[model samples]
Target: MKTNFQKNKIVEHPKESLAPKSGDKKDYTQSEFEEFIIKSGAVGSYMIFRSENEEDEMGISEL
Candidate 1:
């Protein structure tokens, strides 16, 4: 009973958690990023970029 849509519904990527939650406007600066990486580990899986406004430039990276 497999249809074209059902066959295409398979997850292409397992580590494809790039998108953040809606309206979750958390941001950080370069210094903050460096501080975070320093405090925590510098290993991540994926990341998202938003650099329209200087204040709005932020990202979401998996660790």
Candidate 2:
């Protein structure tokens, strides 16, 4: 029995499945973002935090 709400439930990509738990705060600087990247360890060897609105992409060769 699928309802309107159930049907309307949007399915996200597997890679983007887990979202940030906290949504209260917004806006992050490049340095802060870089710190997060280091903590997350998304980057294998070389890493660079680009923007706040960007997601850290892993398992890719540095170019």
Candidate 3:
């Protein structure tokens, strides 16, 4: 008899606050975020922001 194996994918949804809501220190610096990516072994990451004109823009940084 033969047996087959399959790998399972795990997804996590962690709640994070990017900005301080009520004078609380909950935000992280750009360098800190970059360090996190490196430590997490992520291949790449990107960010999206809205400009003053309400236009969506995408930014990518090389790690």
Q: Count the backbone clashes (under 3 Å) in each candidate.
A: 0, 0, 0
Q: Per-residue CA lDDT of candidate 3, range 1-63, in tens?
A: 234586558777678746647887746798998898889976535445567655334443542
Off by over 4 Å in 1: 1-26, 44-63
State which candidate has the highest lDDT.
1
| TM-scores of the models, in the order given | 0.25, 0.26, 0.27
**Ranking of all candidate structures by their lDDT, best first:** 1, 3, 2
Task: State which candidate has the highest TM-score.
Answer: 3
Clash pairs for candidate 2:
none
| True lDDT of residue 61, candidate 3 | 50
C-alpha lDDT (0 to 100) for residue 33 of candidate 1: 93
**What C-alpha RMSD separates each model from the true structure?**
14.4, 14.1, 11.6
Off by over 4 Å in 2: 1-26, 44-63
Per-residue lDDT of candidate 1, residues 1-63 (tens digit): 224644555666787565777887666678999998988987567565557665555533543
**lDDT at 19 for candidate 2?**
54
Global lDDT of model 1: 0.66
